[model samples]
Target: MPEEFGPVGRGEAIQALSREVLIRRSLDISPSGFITIISIIQGVALGLLAQNTFPKPTVLGGIQSVTLLLVFVSVFYYYLTMSVLLRWAPSFLDCFLPFVIASLEIPPAFFLGNAVAWNAWLAGFWFLTMGGLMITTKWSPVSHFGNVRKAHRLLHDLLRELRYTAGIGGFMVAFCALCAHLIPWQRQGWGIVGAGTVLAMVAMIVARTELRASQIHALYGVNRPPFN
Candidate 1:
């Protein structure tokens, strides 16, 4: 199995470790990090502005404001969920899910701005999309302590978590759509709260799964661990 990636000696391992350090350092100062900082600042400013402007909003303003806040929160929540829950660099296909999810929010914001109820119905599709992405992704598991069985089991658990995530999304879709249809038209704000709660609960579940999954990467040794 070691030979599969070619024999890794002490020198090669040290070089790998150095390269990993360099990469981490680069990411710390990366343009993406800078952009993320700027985005946080911008978001804070936008929140303050929205708070002042939407205090005494009209019916349309109220709907639009809540929708705007929901979309903003959805974007941050999903990104945080991906980071905290996955804790690994996903494949490109999996990485693309966030962008697709973000783009999907735009339609609800534009076309369904008339009511929170209508927005809740469309919001379900976002979770449905997440479910589909999890179902479709092919995960590559990390070998734990060079144990093939451990690695395989980790992979299985990951798949299981993906399925769990998908199921959560599916449930949320039904839940959101149901809220949209069942709730009285005048009281759709509760539907928005429900959608947010679903997202939060799903995040908690994924976070717990990831906590268990992270055991695969746990290291115990005298020397520093090698770069994976």
Candidate 2:
């Protein structure tokens, strides 16, 4: 390796790695956790509203179901990708996740949602590009620069939010596309009502998180900032 990429002493390397592990552990979240649960609630509530207020599906229901199943799989692929990234976990491919996601998810995204699919695709594209740069340039996937644990932390934080952004955005748009056909265009104004309801749900989720954080702070005298 070039001097620029030479290994730090073992002691320093160990300390850096230990710090990275601590941050990743602190930032870890499960797919069934609060943020994902709330997003699921948001998607479901909107889907229900559109269903009750619009034309019932007859034949298209099956097709929509299949299409949506695929879409869900796409989002789940993101979920899996993020789960690994959250811990700065390395793949044998050295970060081929986004490439895999882009290949498998983008097709369904294009079929399920135009703008939403692009949102999904863009997430994969970014990871693949950034990951490629990190790898080829000989940066540790977890630490790109020396003596900068903060950079490692930043990567964890960025991937966490990016996962949520891409996954939730894609799911929300997919929900609409799947159900929009149920309501005739003339009556589809109710879809807005569903959207509004989802917005309200998100607001309530945020409020609840803040409330819980405040309660924790009061009880334990620790700073508890609200987060997704």
lDDT of 2 by residue, 42-130 (tens): 36533543453235543233333334343444344444433433334344463343335334433432322232333233334334434
Which candidate has the top score in TM-score?
1
lDDT (CA) for every model shown? 0.48, 0.41
Model 1 alpha-carbon drift over 4 Å, by segment? 1-95, 105-137, 141-152, 155-159, 182-186, 189-193, 196-200, 219-228
Q: How far out, in Å, is residue 77 in model 1?
A: 8.2
Q: Model 2, which residues run further than 4 Å from truth?
A: 1-98, 104-142, 184-228
| Full-model lDDT, candidate 2 | 0.41
